[model samples]
Target: MPGSVIGINMNYGYPGQASRHGDEVSRTRPVATTSEKIMFGAPVVQNTDGSVKAWEAASTAANFAGVAMRKVKAAKIYPYQNFGYYGAGEPCDVLLRGGISVVCAWGTPTIGGTVYVRTNVAEEGSPEEAKIGDFGAEDESGNCIALTNAKWSSSKDERNVAELTILTRQGV
Candidate 1:
Protein backbone atom coordinates (compact mmCIF):
# COMPACT_ATOMS: atom_id res chain seq x y z
CA MET A 1 0.00 0.00 0.00
CA PRO A 2 2.98 2.30 0.48
CA GLY A 3 3.98 4.57 -2.44
CA SER A 4 0.66 3.90 -4.19
CA VAL A 5 -1.69 6.73 -5.06
CA ILE A 6 -5.40 6.21 -4.33
CA GLY A 7 -8.39 8.12 -5.79
CA ILE A 8 -10.96 9.55 -3.47
CA ASN A 9 -14.64 8.92 -4.16
CA MET A 10 -17.46 10.70 -2.39
CA ASN A 11 -21.21 11.04 -2.76
CA TYR A 12 -22.63 14.47 -3.49
CA GLY A 13 -26.26 15.63 -3.48
CA TYR A 14 -27.82 18.51 -5.42
CA PRO A 15 -28.65 21.63 -3.40
CA GLY A 16 -32.13 22.35 -1.99
CA GLN A 17 -33.93 19.82 -4.19
CA ALA A 18 -37.41 21.14 -3.36
CA SER A 19 -39.64 23.30 -1.14
CA ARG A 20 -43.00 22.82 0.65
CA HIS A 21 -46.18 24.88 0.18
CA GLY A 22 -48.48 21.97 -0.56
CA ASP A 23 -47.52 18.99 -2.77
CA GLU A 24 -43.84 18.05 -3.41
CA VAL A 25 -42.01 19.26 -6.50
CA SER A 26 -38.46 19.88 -7.72
CA ARG A 27 -37.01 23.22 -6.58
CA THR A 28 -35.61 24.27 -9.95
CA ARG A 29 -32.02 23.14 -10.61
CA PRO A 30 -31.65 23.11 -14.39
CA VAL A 31 -29.00 21.22 -16.38
CA ALA A 32 -26.60 22.78 -18.91
CA THR A 33 -27.58 22.25 -22.50
CA THR A 34 -25.00 21.69 -25.26
CA SER A 35 -25.77 25.13 -26.71
CA GLU A 36 -23.82 26.79 -23.85
CA LYS A 37 -26.62 29.33 -23.22
CA ILE A 38 -28.64 28.57 -20.10
CA MET A 39 -31.89 30.55 -20.38
CA PHE A 40 -33.92 31.53 -17.33
CA GLY A 41 -37.25 33.27 -16.62
CA ALA A 42 -39.25 33.57 -19.82
CA PRO A 43 -39.05 34.98 -23.29
CA VAL A 44 -39.10 38.78 -23.06
CA VAL A 45 -39.86 40.30 -26.40
CA GLN A 46 -40.69 43.87 -27.32
CA ASN A 47 -44.09 43.59 -28.91
CA THR A 48 -45.22 45.54 -31.95
CA ASP A 49 -47.71 47.33 -29.70
CA GLY A 50 -44.76 49.10 -28.03
CA SER A 51 -45.01 46.97 -24.93
CA VAL A 52 -42.73 44.42 -23.27
CA LYS A 53 -44.08 40.88 -23.31
CA ALA A 54 -42.97 38.13 -20.96
CA TRP A 55 -43.58 34.43 -21.38
CA GLU A 56 -43.12 32.77 -17.98
CA ALA A 57 -45.01 30.96 -15.25
CA ALA A 58 -46.43 33.47 -12.79
CA SER A 59 -45.20 31.83 -9.60
CA THR A 60 -42.33 31.02 -7.18
CA ALA A 61 -39.76 31.59 -9.90
CA ALA A 62 -39.65 35.21 -8.73
CA ASN A 63 -37.63 34.20 -5.65
CA PHE A 64 -35.54 31.48 -7.29
CA ALA A 65 -33.08 31.28 -10.13
CA GLY A 66 -34.16 28.87 -12.85
CA VAL A 67 -30.82 28.09 -14.46
CA ALA A 68 -28.77 24.97 -15.18
CA MET A 69 -26.49 23.72 -12.38
CA ARG A 70 -23.60 22.76 -14.60
CA LYS A 71 -20.25 24.45 -15.06
CA VAL A 72 -19.53 26.31 -18.32
CA LYS A 73 -23.18 27.16 -18.72
CA ALA A 74 -24.05 30.89 -18.77
CA ALA A 75 -27.05 32.34 -16.86
CA LYS A 76 -29.13 35.49 -16.49
CA ILE A 77 -31.27 36.04 -13.36
CA TYR A 78 -33.69 38.37 -15.18
CA PRO A 79 -36.38 38.59 -12.51
CA TYR A 80 -34.26 40.36 -9.89
CA GLN A 81 -33.96 43.07 -12.52
CA ASN A 82 -36.45 45.01 -10.33
CA PHE A 83 -35.66 46.34 -6.85
CA GLY A 84 -37.30 46.56 -2.92
CA TYR A 85 -37.02 45.28 0.62
CA TYR A 86 -37.89 41.95 2.22
CA GLY A 87 -38.07 42.57 6.00
CA ALA A 88 -37.92 38.84 6.71
CA GLY A 89 -34.63 38.93 4.79
CA GLU A 90 -36.00 36.41 2.34
CA PRO A 91 -32.90 35.71 0.27
CA CYS A 92 -32.68 36.03 -3.48
CA ASP A 93 -31.13 32.75 -4.62
CA VAL A 94 -29.17 32.79 -7.89
CA LEU A 95 -27.61 29.85 -9.75
CA LEU A 96 -23.83 29.28 -10.08
CA ARG A 97 -21.73 28.20 -13.03
CA GLY A 98 -18.05 28.12 -13.97
CA GLY A 99 -15.83 28.95 -16.97
CA ILE A 100 -16.57 31.72 -19.48
CA SER A 101 -19.79 33.42 -18.42
CA VAL A 102 -21.72 36.57 -19.27
CA VAL A 103 -24.10 37.62 -16.52
CA CYS A 104 -26.37 40.55 -15.63
CA ALA A 105 -27.35 41.06 -11.94
CA TRP A 106 -30.40 42.94 -10.67
CA GLY A 107 -32.82 43.10 -7.67
CA THR A 108 -35.12 45.47 -5.78
CA PRO A 109 -35.15 45.42 -1.99
CA THR A 110 -38.27 43.69 -0.73
CA ILE A 111 -37.37 44.64 2.85
CA GLY A 112 -34.71 46.82 4.38
CA GLY A 113 -31.73 44.44 4.06
CA THR A 114 -29.10 43.09 1.67
CA VAL A 115 -28.69 40.19 -0.77
CA TYR A 116 -26.78 37.01 0.13
CA VAL A 117 -26.01 33.67 -1.51
CA ARG A 118 -24.83 30.23 -0.52
CA THR A 119 -23.98 29.75 3.17
CA ASN A 120 -24.77 33.47 3.53
CA VAL A 121 -28.35 32.58 4.45
CA ALA A 122 -29.20 33.90 7.95
CA GLU A 123 -28.98 30.45 9.54
CA GLU A 124 -25.70 30.13 7.61
CA GLY A 125 -22.50 32.08 8.33
CA SER A 126 -20.41 34.54 6.32
CA PRO A 127 -16.66 34.90 5.37
CA GLU A 128 -17.35 31.85 3.18
CA GLU A 129 -20.53 33.45 1.81
CA ALA A 130 -21.61 36.01 -0.81
CA LYS A 131 -22.92 39.46 0.20
CA ILE A 132 -23.78 42.57 -1.80
CA GLY A 133 -25.70 45.83 -1.53
CA ASP A 134 -29.05 46.15 -3.25
CA PHE A 135 -28.73 46.37 -7.06
CA GLY A 136 -25.27 44.81 -6.97
CA ALA A 137 -23.78 41.59 -8.30
CA GLU A 138 -22.93 38.07 -7.07
CA ASP A 139 -21.79 35.09 -9.06
CA GLU A 140 -23.96 32.02 -9.15
CA SER A 141 -23.55 30.24 -5.79
CA GLY A 142 -22.33 26.98 -7.31
CA ASN A 143 -20.04 28.49 -9.96
CA CYS A 144 -18.90 31.39 -7.82
CA ILE A 145 -15.35 32.47 -8.60
CA ALA A 146 -15.47 33.45 -4.95
CA LEU A 147 -17.91 34.93 -2.41
CA THR A 148 -18.07 38.19 -4.36
CA ASN A 149 -19.68 41.48 -3.36
CA ALA A 150 -22.52 42.22 -5.78
CA LYS A 151 -20.83 44.18 -8.61
CA TRP A 152 -23.03 46.97 -9.96
CA SER A 153 -23.69 50.71 -9.62
CA SER A 154 -25.79 52.13 -6.81
CA SER A 155 -28.98 54.27 -6.41
CA LYS A 156 -30.90 51.81 -8.58
CA ASP A 157 -30.41 54.27 -11.44
CA GLU A 158 -26.96 52.79 -12.07
CA ARG A 159 -25.91 49.27 -13.09
CA ASN A 160 -22.39 48.26 -12.26
CA VAL A 161 -20.74 45.11 -10.86
CA ALA A 162 -19.25 44.88 -7.37
CA GLU A 163 -18.15 42.27 -4.87
CA LEU A 164 -21.05 43.53 -2.67
CA THR A 165 -23.60 46.34 -2.01
CA ILE A 166 -26.36 47.17 0.51
CA LEU A 167 -30.05 46.40 -0.06
CA THR A 168 -31.56 49.70 1.06
CA ARG A 169 -35.20 50.71 1.63
CA GLN A 170 -35.23 52.73 -1.60
CA GLY A 171 -35.64 52.10 -5.30
CA VAL A 172 -34.70 53.51 -8.75
Candidate 2:
Protein backbone atom coordinates (compact mmCIF):
# COMPACT_ATOMS: atom_id res chain seq x y z
CA MET A 1 0.00 0.00 0.00
CA PRO A 2 1.16 3.57 -0.64
CA GLY A 3 1.77 6.07 2.10
CA SER A 4 -0.77 8.85 2.67
CA VAL A 5 0.09 12.53 2.60
CA ILE A 6 -0.80 14.56 5.63
CA GLY A 7 0.53 18.09 5.31
CA ILE A 8 1.57 20.79 2.91
CA ASN A 9 5.09 21.09 1.47
CA MET A 10 7.68 22.71 3.66
CA ASN A 11 11.38 23.48 3.51
CA TYR A 12 13.14 20.71 5.39
CA GLY A 13 16.82 21.42 4.86
CA TYR A 14 19.68 23.00 6.76
CA PRO A 15 20.45 26.70 6.42
CA GLY A 16 22.58 27.84 3.50
CA GLN A 17 21.65 24.74 1.58
CA ALA A 18 20.99 25.19 -2.09
CA SER A 19 17.32 24.74 -2.95
CA ARG A 20 18.24 23.23 -6.28
CA HIS A 21 21.33 22.07 -8.08
CA GLY A 22 23.43 23.64 -10.85
CA ASP A 23 21.89 27.10 -10.81
CA GLU A 24 23.99 28.69 -8.07
CA VAL A 25 27.06 30.85 -8.60
CA SER A 26 29.53 30.87 -5.74
CA ARG A 27 33.00 32.14 -4.94
CA THR A 28 35.55 31.25 -2.33
CA ARG A 29 36.95 33.88 0.01
CA PRO A 30 38.76 33.96 3.28
CA VAL A 31 37.15 35.47 6.34
CA ALA A 32 38.80 38.65 7.50
CA THR A 33 41.17 38.22 10.41
CA THR A 34 39.23 40.77 12.45
CA SER A 35 35.84 39.36 11.53
CA GLU A 36 33.59 37.70 14.03
CA LYS A 37 32.18 34.20 13.70
CA ILE A 38 29.96 33.94 10.64
CA MET A 39 27.12 31.48 10.66
CA PHE A 40 26.05 29.57 7.61
CA GLY A 41 23.28 31.34 5.61
CA ALA A 42 24.19 34.77 6.99
CA PRO A 43 24.85 37.67 4.68
CA VAL A 44 28.48 38.80 4.17
CA VAL A 45 30.35 41.78 2.82
CA GLN A 46 33.71 42.18 1.16
CA ASN A 47 36.31 44.25 2.91
CA THR A 48 38.62 46.63 1.11
CA ASP A 49 41.44 44.09 1.39
CA GLY A 50 39.39 41.44 -0.44
CA SER A 51 38.42 39.38 2.58
CA VAL A 52 34.86 38.65 3.64
CA LYS A 53 33.10 39.52 6.91
CA ALA A 54 29.62 39.39 8.37
CA TRP A 55 27.37 42.02 6.95
CA GLU A 56 26.52 44.76 9.40
CA ALA A 57 23.74 47.32 9.44
CA ALA A 58 26.30 50.02 8.72
CA SER A 59 27.37 48.31 5.54
CA THR A 60 26.06 49.85 2.35
CA ALA A 61 24.49 47.90 -0.46
CA ALA A 62 27.57 48.52 -2.58
CA ASN A 63 29.65 46.54 -0.12
CA PHE A 64 27.28 43.60 0.05
CA ALA A 65 29.02 40.34 -0.83
CA GLY A 66 26.71 37.35 -0.62
CA VAL A 67 25.25 34.72 1.64
CA ALA A 68 27.59 32.21 3.25
CA MET A 69 27.23 28.58 2.17
CA ARG A 70 27.43 25.66 4.52
CA LYS A 71 30.44 23.40 4.19
CA VAL A 72 30.60 19.84 5.41
CA LYS A 73 33.45 19.25 7.85
CA ALA A 74 34.66 16.31 9.86
CA ALA A 75 33.71 18.11 13.07
CA LYS A 76 30.14 18.32 11.81
CA ILE A 77 29.72 14.56 11.99
CA TYR A 78 26.00 14.66 12.62
CA PRO A 79 23.25 16.80 11.18
CA TYR A 80 22.39 18.15 14.62
CA GLN A 81 26.03 19.13 15.14
CA ASN A 82 26.02 21.42 12.16
CA PHE A 83 25.37 24.64 14.10
CA GLY A 84 29.04 25.49 13.77
CA TYR A 85 30.07 28.73 12.16
CA TYR A 86 33.17 29.86 10.30
CA GLY A 87 35.77 31.83 12.21
CA ALA A 88 38.11 34.52 11.06
CA GLY A 89 40.70 33.51 8.48
CA GLU A 90 38.75 30.46 7.37
CA PRO A 91 37.82 29.93 3.75
CA CYS A 92 34.10 30.05 2.96
CA ASP A 93 31.89 29.72 -0.05
CA VAL A 94 29.70 32.79 -0.74
CA LEU A 95 26.68 32.33 -2.93
CA LEU A 96 26.68 35.13 -5.47
CA ARG A 97 23.49 34.24 -7.24
CA GLY A 98 21.20 31.39 -6.25
CA GLY A 99 18.34 30.00 -4.24
CA ILE A 100 19.45 29.16 -0.69
CA SER A 101 17.71 28.48 2.60
CA VAL A 102 18.16 30.91 5.51
CA VAL A 103 16.75 31.53 8.94
CA CYS A 104 14.21 34.31 9.36
CA ALA A 105 15.57 35.86 12.50
CA TRP A 106 12.47 38.01 12.85
CA GLY A 107 9.41 39.13 10.91
CA THR A 108 7.47 36.78 8.69
CA PRO A 109 8.92 35.97 5.31
CA THR A 110 6.68 36.56 2.31
CA ILE A 111 7.26 35.13 -1.13
CA GLY A 112 8.58 37.71 -3.61
CA GLY A 113 8.93 40.29 -0.85
CA THR A 114 12.00 42.37 -0.17
CA VAL A 115 14.49 40.91 2.27
CA TYR A 116 15.63 42.95 5.27
CA VAL A 117 18.57 42.52 7.61
CA ARG A 118 18.42 43.38 11.23
CA THR A 119 20.53 46.45 11.90
CA ASN A 120 20.14 46.96 15.60
CA VAL A 121 19.23 45.22 18.79
CA ALA A 122 15.52 44.59 19.05
CA GLU A 123 15.58 44.90 22.80
CA GLU A 124 18.43 45.94 25.01
CA GLY A 125 19.62 43.49 27.68
CA SER A 126 17.18 40.88 26.52
CA PRO A 127 17.50 37.47 24.97
CA GLU A 128 15.49 38.74 22.02
CA GLU A 129 18.20 41.25 21.11
CA ALA A 130 18.58 41.22 17.37
CA LYS A 131 21.93 40.36 15.92
CA ILE A 132 23.55 41.61 12.83
CA GLY A 133 22.99 39.44 9.75
CA ASP A 134 19.56 38.26 10.80
CA PHE A 135 17.01 38.23 7.97
CA GLY A 136 13.50 39.60 8.03
CA ALA A 137 10.68 40.88 5.84
CA GLU A 138 9.82 44.24 7.39
CA ASP A 139 12.06 47.26 7.74
CA GLU A 140 11.02 47.96 11.35
CA SER A 141 12.11 51.57 10.95
CA GLY A 142 15.78 51.92 11.88
CA ASN A 143 16.24 48.38 13.08
CA CYS A 144 16.41 46.74 9.67
CA ILE A 145 17.64 47.53 6.20
CA ALA A 146 16.51 46.22 2.85
CA LEU A 147 18.81 44.12 0.75
CA THR A 148 19.28 45.06 -2.87
CA ASN A 149 18.43 42.65 -5.65
CA ALA A 150 17.38 39.91 -3.28
CA LYS A 151 13.95 38.58 -2.39
CA TRP A 152 12.20 35.93 -0.40
CA SER A 153 11.62 32.98 -2.69
CA SER A 154 9.24 31.26 -0.28
CA SER A 155 7.56 31.67 3.06
CA LYS A 156 9.29 30.42 6.15
CA ASP A 157 8.59 26.88 7.27
CA GLU A 158 7.91 25.66 10.79
CA ARG A 159 11.63 25.93 11.47
CA ASN A 160 11.66 29.60 10.43
CA VAL A 161 13.92 28.80 7.51
CA ALA A 162 12.99 30.08 4.09
CA GLU A 163 14.31 30.27 0.55
CA LEU A 164 16.12 33.45 -0.64
CA THR A 165 16.94 34.09 -4.24
CA ILE A 166 19.75 36.47 -5.20
CA LEU A 167 18.93 37.98 -8.51
CA THR A 168 22.40 39.46 -9.07
CA ARG A 169 25.76 39.85 -7.40
CA GLN A 170 25.75 42.96 -5.26
CA GLY A 171 28.84 45.10 -4.56
CA VAL A 172 30.75 42.97 -7.03
Candidate 3:
Protein backbone atom coordinates (compact mmCIF):
# COMPACT_ATOMS: atom_id res chain seq x y z
CA MET A 1 0.00 0.00 0.00
CA PRO A 2 1.25 3.46 -0.76
CA GLY A 3 1.44 5.92 2.07
CA SER A 4 -0.56 9.09 1.74
CA VAL A 5 -0.97 12.26 3.69
CA ILE A 6 -4.52 13.01 4.79
CA GLY A 7 -4.52 16.80 4.85
CA ILE A 8 -2.20 19.77 4.88
CA ASN A 9 -2.06 21.53 8.21
CA MET A 10 0.96 23.74 8.85
CA ASN A 11 -0.41 24.13 12.33
CA TYR A 12 -3.09 22.56 14.52
CA GLY A 13 -6.56 23.62 15.72
CA TYR A 14 -10.08 24.02 14.43
CA PRO A 15 -11.86 27.38 14.19
CA GLY A 16 -13.46 27.02 17.62
CA GLN A 17 -11.84 23.92 19.11
CA ALA A 18 -8.97 24.29 21.53
CA SER A 19 -5.45 23.62 20.37
CA ARG A 20 -2.26 22.70 22.15
CA HIS A 21 -1.24 26.32 22.15
CA GLY A 22 -4.55 27.30 23.74
CA ASP A 23 -8.16 28.02 22.97
CA GLU A 24 -8.88 31.32 21.25
CA VAL A 25 -12.37 32.73 21.57
CA SER A 26 -13.98 33.76 18.28
CA ARG A 27 -16.42 36.67 17.86
CA THR A 28 -19.04 37.23 15.17
CA ARG A 29 -19.36 40.40 13.05
CA PRO A 30 -21.55 41.59 10.21
CA VAL A 31 -20.17 41.77 6.68
CA ALA A 32 -19.73 45.22 5.21
CA THR A 33 -20.22 46.37 1.63
CA THR A 34 -17.19 45.64 -0.55
CA SER A 35 -16.36 44.48 -4.05
CA GLU A 36 -13.38 42.48 -2.87
CA LYS A 37 -13.97 38.83 -1.97
CA ILE A 38 -13.33 37.76 1.60
CA MET A 39 -10.87 34.93 2.32
CA PHE A 40 -9.44 33.25 5.35
CA GLY A 41 -6.49 34.85 7.17
CA ALA A 42 -7.11 38.31 5.76
CA PRO A 43 -7.47 41.16 8.24
CA VAL A 44 -10.71 43.13 8.44
CA VAL A 45 -12.27 46.27 9.89
CA GLN A 46 -15.63 47.54 11.14
CA ASN A 47 -17.78 49.91 9.11
CA THR A 48 -19.81 52.76 10.61
CA ASP A 49 -22.91 50.57 10.38
CA GLY A 50 -21.14 47.82 12.36
CA SER A 51 -20.40 45.62 9.35
CA VAL A 52 -17.05 43.89 8.81
CA LYS A 53 -14.86 44.33 5.74
CA ALA A 54 -11.33 43.56 4.69
CA TRP A 55 -8.58 45.48 6.47
CA GLU A 56 -6.28 47.51 4.23
CA ALA A 57 -3.50 50.04 4.60
CA ALA A 58 -5.99 52.87 4.49
CA SER A 59 -8.03 51.31 7.34
CA THR A 60 -7.42 53.17 10.60
CA ALA A 61 -6.36 51.41 13.80
CA ALA A 62 -9.38 52.48 15.81
CA ASN A 63 -11.50 50.74 13.22
CA PHE A 64 -9.35 47.61 13.34
CA ALA A 65 -11.72 44.68 13.86
CA GLY A 66 -10.21 41.25 13.24
CA VAL A 67 -9.12 38.63 10.70
CA ALA A 68 -11.71 36.87 8.59
CA MET A 69 -12.15 33.31 9.79
CA ARG A 70 -14.10 32.26 6.70
CA LYS A 71 -14.99 33.25 3.15
CA VAL A 72 -17.74 35.85 3.10
CA LYS A 73 -19.48 36.76 -0.12
CA ALA A 74 -21.05 40.15 -0.74
CA ALA A 75 -24.64 40.63 0.49
CA LYS A 76 -24.68 37.77 2.92
CA ILE A 77 -26.33 37.24 6.30
CA TYR A 78 -25.22 39.13 9.38
CA PRO A 79 -23.42 37.82 12.49
CA TYR A 80 -21.04 35.38 10.82
CA GLN A 81 -19.22 32.52 12.43
CA ASN A 82 -16.88 29.66 11.46
CA PHE A 83 -18.90 26.46 11.27
CA GLY A 84 -17.15 24.53 8.53
CA TYR A 85 -14.24 22.13 8.56
CA TYR A 86 -11.38 23.91 10.29
CA GLY A 87 -13.53 26.91 9.52
CA ALA A 88 -12.04 27.58 6.10
CA GLY A 89 -14.85 29.72 4.63
CA GLU A 90 -17.96 30.56 6.59
CA PRO A 91 -18.68 34.07 7.74
CA CYS A 92 -18.18 36.97 10.22
CA ASP A 93 -16.59 34.98 13.02
CA VAL A 94 -13.52 37.21 12.70
CA LEU A 95 -10.50 36.38 14.77
CA LEU A 96 -9.13 39.48 16.33
CA ARG A 97 -5.91 39.74 18.34
CA GLY A 98 -4.40 36.56 19.84
CA GLY A 99 -5.72 34.34 17.04
CA ILE A 100 -3.29 32.16 15.09
CA SER A 101 -3.49 31.50 11.37
CA VAL A 102 -1.60 29.35 8.90
CA VAL A 103 -1.42 31.83 6.04
CA CYS A 104 -0.27 31.16 2.51
CA ALA A 105 2.79 33.09 1.48
CA TRP A 106 1.95 36.12 -0.63
CA GLY A 107 5.51 37.33 -0.09
CA THR A 108 8.81 35.99 1.18
CA PRO A 109 7.74 35.25 4.75
CA THR A 110 10.09 34.52 7.65
CA ILE A 111 9.49 33.10 11.10
CA GLY A 112 9.20 35.65 13.90
CA GLY A 113 9.07 38.29 11.17
CA THR A 114 6.02 40.44 10.54
CA VAL A 115 3.72 40.27 7.51
CA TYR A 116 1.03 42.64 6.29
CA VAL A 117 -2.42 42.29 4.73
CA ARG A 118 -2.41 42.64 0.96
CA THR A 119 -5.41 43.24 -1.25
CA ASN A 120 -3.43 41.63 -4.06
CA VAL A 121 -1.69 38.87 -2.15
CA ALA A 122 -0.41 36.39 -4.71
CA GLU A 123 -1.00 32.70 -4.18
CA GLU A 124 2.73 32.22 -3.88
CA GLY A 125 5.27 35.02 -4.21
CA SER A 126 8.04 37.03 -2.63
CA PRO A 127 6.56 39.37 -0.04
CA GLU A 128 9.69 41.50 -0.19
CA GLU A 129 7.72 43.87 -2.37
CA ALA A 130 4.79 43.76 0.06
CA LYS A 131 4.45 46.73 2.34
CA ILE A 132 5.14 46.24 6.03
CA GLY A 133 2.73 47.59 8.67
CA ASP A 134 -0.14 48.58 6.43
CA PHE A 135 -2.75 48.09 9.20
CA GLY A 136 -3.36 51.86 9.65
CA ALA A 137 -2.41 52.21 13.29
CA GLU A 138 -2.82 55.48 15.15
CA ASP A 139 0.81 56.24 14.28
CA GLU A 140 0.41 54.64 10.85
CA SER A 141 2.72 51.94 12.21
CA GLY A 142 0.79 49.19 10.38
CA ASN A 143 -0.57 46.06 12.01
CA CYS A 144 1.96 43.23 12.07
CA ILE A 145 1.53 39.49 11.41
CA ALA A 146 3.90 37.80 13.83
CA LEU A 147 5.07 34.38 12.74
CA THR A 148 5.13 31.59 15.33
CA ASN A 149 7.57 29.51 13.26
CA ALA A 150 10.24 30.19 10.68
CA LYS A 151 9.24 29.20 7.12
CA TRP A 152 11.29 31.82 5.33
CA SER A 153 11.36 31.89 1.59
CA SER A 154 12.41 34.02 -1.40
CA SER A 155 10.66 32.25 -4.23
CA LYS A 156 7.39 33.39 -5.77
CA ASP A 157 6.54 29.99 -7.27
CA GLU A 158 6.96 28.04 -4.06
CA ARG A 159 4.05 27.87 -1.62
CA ASN A 160 5.32 28.97 1.78
CA VAL A 161 3.44 28.36 4.99
CA ALA A 162 3.39 31.18 7.48
CA GLU A 163 2.00 30.84 11.00
CA LEU A 164 0.78 34.24 12.08
CA THR A 165 -0.23 35.58 15.49
CA ILE A 166 -1.87 38.87 14.51
CA LEU A 167 -0.38 41.67 16.59
CA THR A 168 -1.96 45.12 16.44
CA ARG A 169 -2.50 47.98 18.85
CA GLN A 170 -6.24 47.86 18.32
CA GLY A 171 -8.41 44.99 19.55
CA VAL A 172 -11.99 43.83 19.14
Error of 3 at 8 (Å): 11
Summing lDDT over every window of 10 consecutive residues in candidate 2, give the lowest-scoring window. 73-82
What TM-score, over all chains together, does every model reach? 0.19, 0.86, 0.51
Winner of 2 and 3 under TM-score? 2
lDDT of 1 at 57: 24
Could you tell me the lDDT of residue 5 within candidate 3?
62
List, residue by residue over 86-164, the lDDT tens digit for candidate 2: 7899997889998998998777878899998876775653128478778888777777778887999888888889999
User: On residues 31-136, what C-alpha lDDT tens digit does candidate 3 reach at each position?
Assistant: 6546244445555666766666665546543555655564334433344433232221334666655544444434454444444443333334424555432221
Given candidate 2, what's the lDDT at residue 66? 86
With a 3 Å backbone cut-off (N, CA, C), the pairs that clash in candidate 2 are none
Segments in model 3 whose C-alpha atoms lie over 4 Å from true places: 4-23, 60-63, 71-91, 119-159, 168-171
Ranking by lDDT: 2, 3, 1
How big is the positional error of residue 85 in model 1, measured in Å on the Cα after superposition? 29
TM-score of 2: 0.86
TM-score of 3: 0.51
lDDT of 3 at 25: 47
By summed lDDT, the worst window of 10 consecutive residues in model 1 runs over 163-172
lDDT of 1 by residue, 58-140 (tens): 21212222222222222234343222111111222222221111122333322222333332223343233323211213334
